[model samples]
Target: MIHDIAMIPMIQTQADETQKRKWLQKALNYEIIGTYLQTELGHGTFIRGLETTAIYDPSTQEFIINSPTFSSMKWWPGCMGRSANCCILMAQLYSQGKKYGLHAFIVQLRRFDNHELLPGVTTGDIGPKLGVNSNDNGFCRFDNMRIPRENLLSKYSKIDPDGTYHPPISDKMVYAGMVLSRVNTVVWAAGHLSSGCTIAIRYSCVRRQTELLPGGEEPQIIDYQSQQLKLFPQLAAAYAFIFAAQNIHRRYDQIQSEVMVGDISSLQELHGLSAGMKAFSSLATNLGLEVLRLSCGGHGYSQASGFPRIYGGATALVTVEGEYSVLMLQTARYLVKCVAQAASGNILPHSIAYLTTEPESNCSAKSENDILDLEILVNAYRHRAHRLVNEAAEQLKACLLSGKPQHVSWNENHMVLIKAADAHCHYYTVMNFVQYLQSTEMSKPLRDVLTRLCQLYALYGIDNNAGDLLQDGYMSGEQISMVTNQVAALLVAIRPNAVALVDAFDIPDEMLGSILGRYDGNVYENLYKWAKESPLNQTEVHHSYDTYLKPLLHQSHMEAKL
Candidate 1:
């Protein structure tokens, strides 16, 4: 992940051509391992607030990097603990006695041949976490570490021999590289959510429990409506997120091409798009995995079921890239800008154009038949999102009008802003899901099943947000009950196809790492075999039994005899 997702992108986006030919080649050839080092103990999302300093020396033609305070030490960079020998580091720039803010630099962290930490650097792993123990997340502090000025990633920023700084052509391009990572995160996060969905769904189809009929053979748990309620919506979310991921990936490419040609107009739009995509996809998909895991009953709680590992990785997505709530606020800040632009009579970007025309006070799709119509479902999402965005906007305005400080007002209204951001992301997801289905042509069989999946996804979203949908008399209670019934019916309709649906994900068993989710439907036999392989089973009795259990039992017996 550090190599492909973070390292490669940094070099490709910011490294000079010569630096690229050297470092990029080494990265591609697997000759050098590296990770991104940016977030410090004191600051993460606020880049300008980072405390690490890099002061230039004109005589030596090098920069002295230091973590001046304990809180300034770099933290949470994956692979830096053990595997990585180098990193693209972010540090504050000082030259000609002027502070130039944050800039990226390529720093060799360890001696290449000996793999020993370089002079003036201290680094190591941060031990155990909730999940993803396999990854070596690490921390490092610099003690006036010196590097040649040439090591500066100068594609967008540069330094002159006399300790002068040259800024990027456009300020917006400074943030362009982050957009790529956020989009990649969207895809990576969705992949995990789907993995969990695939595991849970396949396991549900294979595992059998309670008998639904008197004296009849036990039935597969997939037949249970309650199980479907848990599994299908998550299954639907996996699909919705997949479509949303693809949409954002393609959109990133287009805006990236524009950035390459020096047109930075679309950069902010891309930033907001990628930020919200990463935030929402990671946050929602992680929750979806948890729901899917619980749906599997006792097995999901066991490490052997694979939720342990999958969820461990999924859980990190919310905090990395950017913390979910922080990114949502970033997204909401941009949305507020766009709303202001719309009110000024400017044309809005395609993604957010709906905000240009105010949402109707009441929903037109409250009826059962109209509710399921894909366009109406799309509009319903739009209405909820539009209202929430305006609500957040107006609330912020009210706070500002009440004479509070900007920072205080923002903090006071963050929850409302976060809700708006969430609603907007959900709207974008449903819109993308519907648009992808309509635009892409497929076999009728494939189309029919996807359409059903899409319907379930939309209705499930509406059902989940019934209160929001019903606000201002948009959707009535009777109609929401109908939505509940329809959700159940969709789950039943999706049951026969659940196995086939997850099968389409085409995840190999090796990647799944779960006996219960094996494709061959031999869960029980494999689970037994797996249990036998436990190290505790290697001995007839555990050593603790003799050292601890036997002594206690013997003591109890002597007392009883006395």
Candidate 2:
């Protein structure tokens, strides 16, 4: 419902206040169910490729909408399978045989009272998915459907009763809704990552493993350095992601403010930031959740452990909103542009200002102490990211210099380009985490714990991509080794606070729903109770035995006597 309402401002026009009011009021009051229908069978994230057509008929003041092919049918919209009676659709518009770009339109899909499919509207459920099955994801196709000319969402573009078309002042306004979704997904991923970390950490604190000393009782699994190594960093990352998301969301708000005044200078930057973080954050959380689940050993594989459902739901996000690789490339293209601007001495946006920085000869760290400094780490990351972006830009230039076409050059350098974008996003996220820690006021003990976690998050990022650091001359082999040791040491320091850290997430047990991760540490008892409550265990299960096994045994005995 919120997503549907959000579409209003994106396509709201001065010409159709009454139309906007009618739909907006219905949506807000739940008088009508609505959804955004952008993705189709042929197009998911790339909106430019949408194939649906809306041809205006000036004589009748109506637009004929049609899904010319099966691939043009709208797919993967929530509530469209059965619930949504209307949708905000993206379709190419044509007036007087001059095709304008894709525009939004309001189209009815179902009847309001009986929930029947409208004439010329075909829809059905898309069936079960990896997760979020309760959403009722649906498919839709239009067959020469005629809607009033007023149905064309004219906020950015409009048509008169005489069929004169007026394009929006800024075409970028068409995508504000999608940018909002991308930013929201980053914050959404943070919540899921925190939940998974909380469950795994709490369970590890209660689960015991082999004893470290002779004749001593087994210690909690959380005591193992390997366990801490897997869980603690993710705990820190969950916090880092929340901080990053907050920053991005705030920037989005600012972007919205600027857009209201017809200032779109920041739109491109916001798009790149949101897309990169959306991809990076979802992938990190998905991978982290799986690692946390496996850190619980065999219990993690069971549905009762709560990891499978969490993992399933999270994995679905990687392909939604945008595909991971595609978005990375989008950010890469933006980075390449930044490199070009920086080379010409043109001022760059603050997000990519690092591209203008020259790597300092003494940037490489000498000792573990120096490596642990937040300022040093941020500088190193900036240097490596700067080098990577420039390197990718150089590769593209090299390809083009060799006489390859622009598209061919892009294809050849795409792999390197994505890596560059990923590096930039990581650096930016760590910067956000570090800056948040430096600026916020808190108790000494809380601040100390957070600073350690922030360090862990930043260093872990550096260590994971140490090849980038080393290859870009930001760190030497010795320094990389020192980073490895520092990571181990941080794990030890963070071990004692693992439970406390996860508890700080404050996820309630009711929401967690894991037998192995309950707050009371009664895993075995809960498992037993769960088994007992199973339908199979409700009775002695003699019915199956009497129906098939007993008869089989009787026949076997008769045959043996013969």
Candidate 3:
């Protein structure tokens, strides 16, 4: 949180030289702990609706910060409760009796001398959570806390001694920190899901179950066709998301450089891409990880399986920067605009140029092999996204035509709009996965295997959204069947190498922390060893058995006799 969320706003998009000298250097060096404090007890995802206030007092040249209501207290910041000494606080700025919108201010929470809460600042742990209890995801409240005017990290916007507000040229610049965080979320999703994938794949390879023939040895679970279906497409997805993250990371770096040089032209485009990818990657990864866990059967339900911890950390990405649905809608907003631009003969950005493609195109596949071609698969995904976006735009247009206001129209059509965003992101993932393989210099044998993975990813996606693909007659029912069959065939072809694919992820056993997924395939022995290490097992019988169990059992026996 300190590195990715807390200190990012100051270092990446704000904080002038003087501000850097004051706080940035020490923050970078970890001399003081920090967190990003934005979500309040009552508000999250809606940045503009935040209630914490930083009222500028010009006469004193200080800002009086207050969490005036219980709901206004900052909540859910990873380290705010006890670990952090300060935060990059998001509060509505009040200057000269005028609200100046949400702004980021570096607020000191604790006195550096002894690490005590500053005067008028009260903060503590938010208590145990569903997961990540080890992290002090804390809440904080301020009772008219005061900080010098210089404390406001002023790069995008600034205020004079007399409280004259000078806003940034682009209002969106204020959200640069969030864009960076969302981009990071994509990578985080891939990495965390990769861990779950690693554990589950290894376990599937080592854990044998059931008998194909009576009195025969059990087969490795990975040999099951159903297991392949569960794991392989998701394995493909981990790669797809990783490649997508790389693409966005490169774009972010380019746009960030442009921002540094006063070119805000691509910021919004980058913002939309990152938002959509963040939503896409996190959702796919979370859902895929859960699927992998379930495939592990009962053991997957245990904390010792490591899915619980991976899930706790990975699922946080869906809601941290912004909730997944909201983020997708933001991307959908951009997509709708692009569709209009395309209709007006405007040149769309390269990433979304597919919007301008002919929407009535039909699949050119006559056989399963034709549909399995990587190019054909990519085209299928692209067509689905293009059509989905157009339909969503038309839906919103119909609502507007029916006398609904823009927001109302948007609300009524949000589901389709979100679907559009989802389709666009899936297309982006498959598209990037293909392009990545094309550019890389891997060996031919490796490339063939990767191409198989990409085909599985695209076809699986197509199979899942078969109705959408069939709706426009883009793909006939026969073609859809071909896609489904191709997916199953790919699964069988990839099964022998499922463990190898996840092994390439190279997550260390220590990091994986899964007994069933250990490299040695010693699951049963390790399970016994791990169970013995439990604190309750230190004695032959737990103290609870003597204290409570004995009394309960004795009473029950006497009642039965009666």
The candidate that wins on TM-score is 1
Per lDDT, what order, best first? 3, 1, 2
Q: Write the per-residue lDDT of candidate 3 for residues 227-246, one digit (tens) a residue.
A: 98888888999988888889
- Highest lDDT: which candidate? 3
Task: Give the candidates in order of TM-score, highest first.
Answer: 1, 3, 2
Candidate 3: count of backbone clashes, pairs at least 3 residues apart or interchain: 0
Clashes of 2: 2
lDDT of 3 at 199: 86
> What is candidate 2's lDDT per residue for 150-234, written digit by digit as tens?
8887656789998899888787677777788789788878888988898888889888889889889999898888898889889
lDDT of 3: 0.85
Q: Write the per-residue lDDT of candidate 1 for residues 202-259, one digit (tens) a residue.
A: 8988888888788988998888888888888888888888888898888888887887
User: What ranges in model 1 sit over 4 Å off?
Assistant: 1-4, 44-50, 68-77
State which candidate, 1 or 3, has the greater lDDT: 3
User: How far out, in Å, is residue 192 in model 3?
Assistant: 1.7
